[model samples]
Target: MVSTTFEDLNNSKKKLITDALLNEFSHHTLSTAQVSRIVKESGIARGAFYKYFDNLTDAYNYLYHFALQDIHQTITTDYHKKFQPDDYVDQVREFTEKSTNSRYFELVKMHLLFNEAHFSTPVSNHLIIENEFYWATQVLIHDAIKQLMLDPSSKELILQKLANVLHRLAKEDD
Candidate 1:
């Protein structure tokens, strides 16, 4: 979580810090990130970095969530309502296209490639045991995104494979 002091900063100052953090995290994993670099890039004192975040992880989480929100806004599907496999695929496609083209691309790629596994906290998997279909869909969608990141040229093929599996699962659920 960001500190109140960070939230209180003016828009320009906030952008400077956040943009600096984004650039740092995008190029390096959490373990390798340096506050010295962030402060230098943002033109802030080293002490100010501590004032804005509890630590490096907090800063990373803040930036990650901010990127998520920005990407989510580009999705056209209404997640609040129930959706079909096609709708889910459309959402995934939109997310892939938008994130790949956005400033957060490297940040997102680094998260998927390295940062997620390094974090001590595990991603929630209760849904796997509770709803197999939904869990499978989530897995397929995530893997597709991973594939896209690894081999962007295979986006269509990967998405098609995911769609095929999801469609089969949806049919079985009937």
Candidate 2:
């Protein structure tokens, strides 16, 4: 968690630090990121960096959640409602397109490629409900995203496979 001191910063100052963290994480894995670089880029003192975050991992978590919130807002599907395989595929496709073009592209790519498994807080498995089908679909969706990050040209094929599996799961549940 970030310090209250960081939360107290004005929006513009927060954005500056956010941008710097994004740039640093986009270019380097968490293992290689440098506080000095972030401080220099954000125009904050090294001491202020520590004051704002407990450590580099805290800063990275902050940036990760920040990007996630922005991306989630762009997705229109309500997963809490009925799970529509086609609709989910469409949503994933839209997300892939937007994320590829967004400012956080490299950061997301870097995370999927290298840093994701190393996160201090492992990715959540919590779902809206506790059905095994829902859990499987969620895992598959995440895998599809990772696959898209690795080979963007395979998107149509990947989405098709994902849709096929999801439809099969839905049918089985009936």
Highest-scoring model, TM-score: 1
Span of 10 residues, lowest total lDDT, candidate 1? 121-130
RMSD to true structure for each model, in Å: 2.1, 2.1
Write the residue-wise lDDT of candidate 1 on 16-133 in tens digits: 9999999999999999999999999999999999999988999999999899899988676443355398888888889989899999999999999999875543334544464677
Candidate 2, residues 7-93, lDDT tens digits: the string is 999999999999999999999999999999999999999999999999999999999888977877868845578878998898888
Best by lDDT: 2
Among residues 3 or more apart in sequence or in different chains, the pairs in candidate 2 whose N, CA or C atoms overlap within 3 Å are: none
Candidate 1 lDDT at 112 equals 93
Give the poorly placed runs of model 2, Cα more than 4 Å off.
Answer: 76-79, 120-123, 127-129
**lDDT of all predictions:** 0.87, 0.88
The true-structure Cα RMSD of candidate 1 reads 2.1
- Residue 145 in model 2: shift from native, Å? 0.6
